[model samples]
Target: MIEATGLTKRYGKTLAVDNLTFQVEAGRVTGFLGPNGAGKSTTMRMILGLDNPTAGQVLIKGKRYRELKDPLRTVGALLDAKWVHPNRSARAHLRWMAAANRIPAHRVDEVLDTVGLTSVAGKRAGAFSLGMSQRLGIAGALLGDPEVLLFDEPVNGLDPEGILWIRKFMHRLADEGRTVFVSSHLLSEMALTASDLVVIGKGRLISQSSTKEFVSRATENAVKVRSPQLEQLRTLLVQAGADVTDSDDGVTVSGMDSEKIGELAAANRIALHELSPQAGSLEQAFMQITGDSVEYHTGLEAEAQHVLEPTR
Candidate 1:
């Protein structure tokens, strides 16, 4: 398990991370989410002892990262896939990391195979494609067979198949009772990959909850209702204090439940063709919750949105 208590980081005259506290438990994939410049990279660096926290503490298995006898075996991280030496072969890279940690040379081959980079293990790191480089990075992370793994944007520039492979691989690791914490800007992918989320804004903890709970709480719940008498249903919903938006097939409803909508239609003898509750999307929840936290705003969003709005 990984734990951060009052974790903070500061630069000269700048506060990068606030007093943040969160936990990453075993056997779960926890997503670290935040807007750009929200200090996510700072936090991850602090966690790995790459950068010293100005205040507070982050621990791995109850001990500071520096205190670990075999740090790589305890916590494996792939913060940047491009951090490897450009001239080094994939095998040469993993061999050195394993050697530094006193890991057997045989383990190097194991990890290469694990990440499916064994075929290209002899290739120079610089020559590898982005997808191949990502796999090599994961191979390094697994070199020590660590119980805790951290990844930053593991699928940022991958093809669909590459993304899917990484997703399934992380799940396999978590299923083996390892702690998997990853950071990414891909909301849809994160929603599918992470079971729990550690969301932050302005370097402060906004929420830490299961993926389902987080989305359900932040995004508006709406039910879609389709009827032959669509106009009648819209008028009824508005009169009953529900927000209604027209859709191609029907109307989307808020401030009312499916049961209530069904009752209204039945009472009026309106024929109902479809009634389904819309699931909250991760993108919707992120935009809604992180509206004020976004560090870089184009300010053109409103203008762009106005251009898209239909004429009344």
Candidate 2:
């Protein structure tokens, strides 16, 4: 397990991360999510001891990262796939890391095979494609056979097949009772992959909860009702204390479930055309939750209006 308490970082006048406290439990895939410029990378660096915190500290398995006897064996991270020596072969890179950590030379081959880079084991790091480079990075991370793994955008430049493989691979790691902490901007994938989420915005903790609970809490559950007597049904639903929003062909009822809506419609003798539940998506919930924490705002609507205004 990874625990951070009052983790804070600063660079001159800029406060990167502030009093961030969270835990990544074992045997689960925990997604670290935040908007751009939200200090995610900085926090990861601090966790890895790449950057020191200004105030607080983070511990990996109850020990600070720098205090570990063999840091790589305790925590393996793939922050940058391009962190390899350009001239080194995939096998050579893993061998170097293994040698540094006193990991057996045979373990390099094992991890190389594990990441499916055994075929390209002899290829120079610089010549490898983005997908291949990512695999090589994963190979290095696994070389130490660490119990805790941290991956930052591991599938950033991969094809669909590669993405699926990494997703399944993370699942396998978690299944083996390892702590897997992944940071990615892919909300949809997180919804499918991570069981728990550590969500932050503007260098502060926003929420830490199960993926299901986060989505349900951040987004609304509504039922869309379409009927021949739509206006009458709307009146009845409003009177029944459901928040009703008019649509072109139906009314959306919130603070109520589809079953209740259907029962109410049936009781009023309303001929229903459709009663569909609008379950909120991870994207919708993310947008709603992180609306204010975005570092940059386009304000595109205002720009468009200015363009349309009559020139003086």
Candidate 3:
């Protein structure tokens, strides 16, 4: 398990990470989420001992990363897929890493096959495409068979198939009781892949909870009702302290659940064609929670005007 206690970092006058306290339990995929400039990368670096924290500390299995006898065998990370020698072949890269950590040479071939890079084992790192580079990076992370893994945007440039592969691979790691902590901007994929989430914004913790609970609490649940007597239903729903909004075929009621709305309609003898509850999606919940933490805002009109203006 990974634990952060009052973890904080600063760069001169700017604070990069605030007092972050959270735990990434074993046997689950935990997503680390944040908007741009939210200091996610900074926190990950601190966790790996790549950067020194201004205050506080992060521990891997009850010890700091620097204190580990064999860091690779304890915690595996793929922070930057491109941080490899361009002249090195995929096999050569893994071999070097294995040699550094005293990992067996045969284990190199095993990881190469595990990441499906055995076919391109002889290819230079520079010649590999983005997807292939990511695969190679993952292969190195698994070389030590670490119980903890950290991946930063592992699916950034992947195709649909590659994305699916990574998702299942993370799940498999968690199933083996490893601690899997992934940081990504892909909310939809995170929703499907992560069992829990750690959301940060502006160098501070925003939320930490199970994926289902976080989304449900952040979004407003509403009930959609469709009926031939739409007008009557709307009137009744509004009078019952529910906010009603009209749609093409129905009305959406908030401030109440589907069960209450259904009972009200039934008692009023209103014919109902469809009544369904609408739960907010992960994206919607993310936007609602991080709306204020967004560092950049784009004005559509300003952008359009700027684009339309001719320049030298």
Winner of 2 and 3 under TM-score: 3
lDDT tens readout by residue for model 2, 1-312: 999999999999999999999999999999999999998999999999999999999999999999999888989999998998999998898888888899999998898888888888998999999889888888887777899999999988888988899999999999999999999998888888899999999999999999889988877788888899988998988898888988778888888899998899889899999999988777667766776787876788346434433235
lDDT per residue (tens digit) for residues 49-78 in model 3: 999999999999999999999899999999
RMSD of each: 2.7, 4.8, 5.6
Q: State every prediction's TM-score relative to the real structure.
A: 0.95, 0.89, 0.93
Which candidate has the highest TM-score of all?
1
131 Cα displacement, candidate 1 (Å): 1.6
Stretches off by above 4 angstroms in model 2 are 226-235, 238-251, 271-276, 300-312
**Colliding residue pairs in candidate 2:** none
Candidate rank order under lDDT: 3, 1, 2
